[model samples]
Target: MTPFTIETNQYLTQETQGFYHTDFGGVNLPNNPNYLYKLKNDPHHNWSDDWIRQSQEQLYRVLLIDLPEVQNHIGKNPLTICVVPRAKADNTYNPNQLLFKAGVRNAIITLGNSFIDGTNYIQRHTNTKTTHLRQPIDGYNNDGSNPYVGITNATCNISNNVVGKDVLLIDDIYTRTVNIDEDAIQALISKGAKSVSFYAIGKTVFNH
Candidate 1:
């Protein structure tokens, strides 16, 4: 399938594109419920073995098909995989990390371990107000003052430097605004990643 381009806007300096396997109709759309949305939002109930297996299956399909296309776009450079970190409140075995690991394992089995590094390099420093009900601009900040500055002070745990590495940033969902995802890409680039491309299961379309 053709990938969708995430256009550069006020919050982003570069155009980061990605592909979503399914469409998510904004928030609280009872008539059009999305499986990916259910998995992300209701993690407490959705973290069962059956749910996890299903989630992995869906992600595996994407890695098996969409990932190769993304790799072709980047040429010879290997891509390291990193998930956009969850809020501090979700530090304990969050669904995002679990989903990322599942996809990484599948990638390793098919593409080889060298192509994708499953490193939890980026992390949240503190908890911020949930962005679930807010606009993109109302999300985290990196203004050198806010406690939860998105990826501002996010830790990079790689032993060797990532001076010229290409990074494939993964997130569970993409909002209409770019604050969180853009901050994440910026943080990775700032830490010496040569370039960053994004991927997610779905992109939200706000009703308003």
Candidate 2:
């Protein structure tokens, strides 16, 4: 699969680089369903053993095919893998972590357990209200701060020790307003990350 690049100006000095497998097509509504819609909505909440197995298989395929290309793009920087924190509500069992673990299992890139540290370093403190409609370029805080202001402010508790590390951030979906992902990048950079790259399984393509 050819990797498509996603550029974002959320960071002033550094632009976040993103890559994904396919377009999100559109919002996953009950009446209008797509793969990403089904995965994100997960109306039945079927993220069980079977779902995990299937998701692992799918992620393995992506890593097997695309990881090499990603590595080439990243070049030879000592790398660490981080993930966008799941919502405070969804920490019960994050399927995103499961998917990432699967990818690591099949990855050609050499990484140790210390490299994949999403839960330990960065985290989400509050859950934003869910909305199907589009909103302004705003952060998720009810206080009218940046959607990820907490992260940038270090209130979400990011480790300030990653000064020289190159981080590869992972997420399951990419939406037009990728504030959370971008904020995570900014937080990492502020904490001293040398560079950050993002990858997601799906990129939302709004279709009116």
Candidate 3:
């Protein structure tokens, strides 16, 4: 996929890309694209708030189509999306919370910790049962003390999520961080995800 392209849906194919036909019938890019595209310039007090509130409903619409895939892999929706927000940001976006009403039939979980006191995106999406893998308190991280707490908690959370079943992890952007995300996936596999694949909504205008 190109850098700007997003994962609209898993089942989509060449015939389906520009085609508009499904159980729901007819899918078009400009006319209800698989997912909404929200740039930083979009409205909102904060970037996290803007993305969570805007992308949830639309994103879930596509995510539900993959329910079979999710069940095949983890057996449910409301599956945890390990959203890693822009660095130096607070409360990264979490898709699980937003996909609840759209048809997520399970609990949601947050991977990384949120700033401003656990400002989780789960609340913004599904009110269904969920959990947060607390980013360990390793002193104020503002001065670049260490960012491992969040990733560490993520590893632990992914490792423990496998209760004799597979799981899915979500994230927003993936590039150089693929290695880092791979690390998280490794941890998830260690915990019990039959497989770990990502549904990246958007790519960076700038990739490090």
- lDDT (tens digit, per residue) of candidate 2 on 1-208: 2355555564434666778766655554432213333334232444566665665566556656665566577673445666665544335335653445435444534344324444346655545433333553344332323454434444356666567887877766666564666777777877788887877776666622
- For model 3, residues 100-122, the per-residue Cα lDDT tens digits are 22222222211112101111321
Q: Model 2 Cα displacement at 206 (Å)?
A: 1.6
Give TM per candidate: 0.71, 0.67, 0.40
**Each candidate's clash count:** 0, 3, 10
For all candidates in order, the CA lDDT equals 0.60, 0.56, 0.33
Lowest lDDT 10-residue stretch of candidate 1: 142-151
Residue ranges of candidate 3 with Cα displaced over 4 Å: 1-54, 66-159, 203-206
Best by TM-score: 1
Model 2, position 9, has a per-residue lDDT of 60
The deviation in Å at residue 178 for candidate 3 is 5.2
Task: Compose the digit string of candidate 1's lDDT tens values, residues 1-208.
Answer: 3477766655556787666555567546753324454345343344566765676676677667766776786563577777775544336445654555556556656877547664455545555444654443433342322223334444323323455777888777776564677777666666677777887766666522
Name the candidate, 1 or 3, with the larger TM-score value: 1
Ranking by TM-score: 1, 2, 3
Measured on C-alpha atoms, candidate 2 has an lDDT of: 0.56
